[model samples]
Target: MRNVTDRIFQGAISVFIRKGLQATTQEVAKEAGVAEVTLYRRYSTKENLFITVIKNVLEKKFDSHVLEIAKENETEVFLMNIIEDRLEILSKNYDLVKMLLSESLRGNLANEINLPDIIFSSLKKGLEYHFELKNQTVDIDFCARQLGGIFLSYVVLPNAQPFNKLTLQEKKDIARKHAKAVLATI
Candidate 1:
């Protein structure tokens, strides 16, 4: 039963990425390889279905997509871990990221999901492991905004900006610099 629901949702995810959250039930049903009546019986409404889809994606990503980012580097050395991991994800799932960033610009996604704040986790853990203390309870939300804003600006940058066309090393440098800037505040 759960697998059936997940399959339906996975199909819906593809539909959402290909189309949008406002797509029709008929389209979703077709995408899920189920009859329209079957879909309606299962979900009752498109909003229910869409929310379920979003919830499922969020849960799954939290469990699986958000990798455990840890580093042996003390102090500023922990910075590169943030950059390398994010760049890896951005490079592979560029389109999904593009979607997230674009929708965020249009005020689509939530004001950043609050839990599973891996950045804070990394900082606290790194600091403690390095035998340091007195770190404040960081504003995880603001850090989320900072990172999101960076990616959003980078993705939407005009073709003419040299920084927009930065090489991998330049990208890493910029990303690390931004991460360090935020880390200082946290």
Candidate 2:
């Protein structure tokens, strides 16, 4: 049962990433190597299937323990960890995030499905908490905006190598640089 559901979930992700919400259940069924009835049994409608896929993707990309780790660690260490984690998630899901970004820019996706808001809110809150703990006077919202912009510009540099394809050293260097920049602003 679990395997079947996993297949459907992966299939839905693949198809939706390729076709967006316009993908049909029949396409997903074929992609999953399952019957259409199997998909229907679990996800009554295409919208339901898409909702599940999006939810699962977000849950997977956003680490539940990230904020906890941020709260427990030193400010610089937490910023580095957050940078690395955010970059990794964005790199892994570049296509999905890119597609969602384009759609959201067109005012098609609401706040619920807006990937940028979902991804950055956690980081912003974590930064805010860290600043509060240290009694720093920094504006966390502006810091988050700057950090997000830097990370994103590097991640999606057109005509350049994709972030995920970068060497591990390169990623670490970028994360370290991001951490330094944030720290300097404080």
Candidate 3:
């Protein structure tokens, strides 16, 4: 039941992100290939269903991966991937991201999810992974959000421009430099 619910919700995130929550349950159910009744059966209401979808994606994609990567030995490399690799992940889900951002600005607060907690969580994980040595000390959460905010901005950019407005190699090169700047605070 949970797996089915999660799958439906993940699909919902894609649909909702693409079409906005003003998008009907029927459309989402169609995207999910589940009956509309099935979504209502699992979620009870549109708001509840949207929340479920947001929370699940938040945990599975955004939170977990950041935590896992923060544990890596090479913090620089790990951070670079967070900055760059995650952008690739965004490319695959660009439409959804586009919808989410637009919806947020249009007075759909109920449709929103927690931002600071998510940012703080990723930062904490990154810090834990990067600064385990006894002699080193760093404010992991602050730096994470600072740098993470920068990356997040890049993610939600118009997508009309490539990451660097150039080839893949150029984006990676820029990301590498950005990652270094992010690390400089640590």
Best by TM-score: 2
lDDT per residue, candidate 1, 1-186, as tens digits? 456676688778777666665578888878777788877788898767766666565545433423334324443445455554544444454455455545555655553432234334443444444333334454555655665555445545643434424577876787678778867766
- lDDT score of residue 134 within candidate 3: 30
Name model 1 segments beyond 4 Å from true: 1-3, 62-67, 70-77, 97-144, 158-175, 183-186
Model 2 — which ten-residue stretch has the worst lDDT?
63-72
Question: What would the per-residue lDDT of candidate 3 be over residues 105-149, giving only the tens digit for each residue?
Answer: 786746246543654576576666667733357787667676767
Predictions ranked by TM-score, top down? 2, 3, 1
- Candidate achieving higher lDDT, 2 or 3: 2
Which segments of candidate 2 are over 4 A away from where they belong?
135-137
* Residue 128 alpha-carbon offset, candidate 3, angstroms: 2.9
Root-mean-square deviation per candidate = 5.7, 2.4, 3.6
Whole-model lDDT values for every prediction: 0.56, 0.78, 0.68
- Candidate 2 lDDT, tens digit per residue, 68-159? 75675577788877887777777778888877766667776645676767767777778877777777778878888887887678556873
